[model samples]
Target: MAERIFIDTQSANAMIDNGSAYVIDSTLLQNENSRIKHFENRIRGAKYFSIAEIRDTSAPLSLAWPTFQQFTEAMIKIRLPNDGKAVIVYDQTGFGTAARGWAMLKYFGYPNVFILDGGLPKWVAEGRPTETGEYELNFTDPVDWRQYLVTEHHEMRVLIDTVEQIVNQKNSGDNRFAIWDPRPPNMFQAGSIPTAVNLPASTFFNADKTIKSPEEVRELLQQHGLGGEVITSCMKGINASLGYALQKYSGNDHAHIYTGSFEEWKKLKG
Candidate 1:
């Protein structure tokens, strides 16, 4: 069976209105646009957590995986539904930082998660409503959200040691897994681990930023020798999560993200 990957803006809006869904904007408010913090408006009732917010602050690394303690604490702060509910993630574009939020939620065991196909741009194009102003840190929930705090889900992520072991296995004869690097080719070729391949995440998106069709995605991944279980890695976990989402959308659910990515890998390996 195929794993679900995306939700259209209309269906997503309906769910958000009916209180069956939570929307998260996982834009990575840095690098090329570091000064731009909150956007002017967001999907109605959407809680915004730029990738930087969910990032692990326990150390000096960039966007390292959040610890269980950090994740729970942040969710509590967001007043995320205590009861299990659908979470729809998005970024400025559909395929960028949204995958990070999706990956994190899926890793933590949220079963009904999807990325908003085409993201906020698509939502606005269809005349969906949005809310203005900076996010309120003290927004109160009217439901029993007080009781639905999450338990940490640890099964979908691989650590530095696990990645090393995979490299060793590949150097020998194992081909059961592949590390799918989604960065630019030059960046990948310059310094990537053994058994990793360049499969840039950008190829999975359409011109308007919506994800490509499942058929197209399958072809692209297959062409790159990406099948079965995969570990998606990049400079940070950002692009890695995109690869994970692409695979899941293409019906291959065995993919995992090396959440610390090459940044963490290099640090630990050194």
Candidate 2:
């Protein structure tokens, strides 16, 4: 697996000036237009691409990963860079959906992907330069997308079968993995996969939306005694991805995301 990369506003701005970084706005479409416009304007030359552009909308949970072919198409449509440029994904809400975008790109074999710590909100708070209007990508050939697809890592995702196996292990008292719930305390208290532990994703960020220091994140994970293979889940997979990213950021490469997560788990149980 490639090392997860994260950058502060200063580093991101430097990369942008050199034309080696491609900024992706991963904010949800339903976000207020003014908010979206403000974000776009703040990051000059940033391209807008939502998770919806690459997800399988027909899935019950809606955030399901796309098929290989579908992913290829989306990459072409989004005009992703083909020159091995680094990707910086960001959203209005800290690293929420932006983490998902980073995970997707990494799963697809893109090595230089990074998330903008604190996202657009932090950038604005820092009083960065702002420019209005949209930016366009110069489309690359669809065939180029295939060169970057890494099949082995793609299979590392935690699917329903893996979740079922985890449940079985818990029932038999032979558990080999830990499940991390990134939802709120109330949601975790109401119900979750049996034996799953609550570790709200919010704990990983500061009040200003910036992520906690690596030492702080590592200490928090250690305090929970969470180790070895761990799977992260939430109502959908958005927050879960953030958990997975946080784990990776803390140097736990074995961390994975339960893509179906709580939504699919509930459906399956019913």
Best by lDDT: 1
Model 1, position 229, has a per-residue lDDT of: 79
Compared with the true structure, what per-residue lDDT tens digits does model 1 show for residues 1-270?
467788888889999999898888878755655214334767887787656777678777878778777876677667765466899988865466888888888776677889999988889888898877765654555545455456566667788899999999999989888889998798887777667989788888888888778989998898888977788898878888888878888888688878888887778786
Q: Predict model 2's lDDT versus the native.
A: 0.76
- C-alpha root-mean-square deviation, candidate 2: 3.0
In model 2, the clashing pairs are none
Candidate 2 lDDT tens digits, 129-210:
6577544543555456544444336554888888888878978887578888877899777767767889887887899878
Q: After superposition, how far is residue 64 of candidate 2 from its true place, in Å?
A: 1.1
Residue runs of model 2 more than 4 Å from their true location after superposition: 1-4, 29-42, 135-152, 189-191
TM-score, per-candidate, Cα-based: 0.89, 0.87
In TM-score terms, candidate 1 sits at: 0.89
Worst 10 residues of 2 by lDDT: 143-152
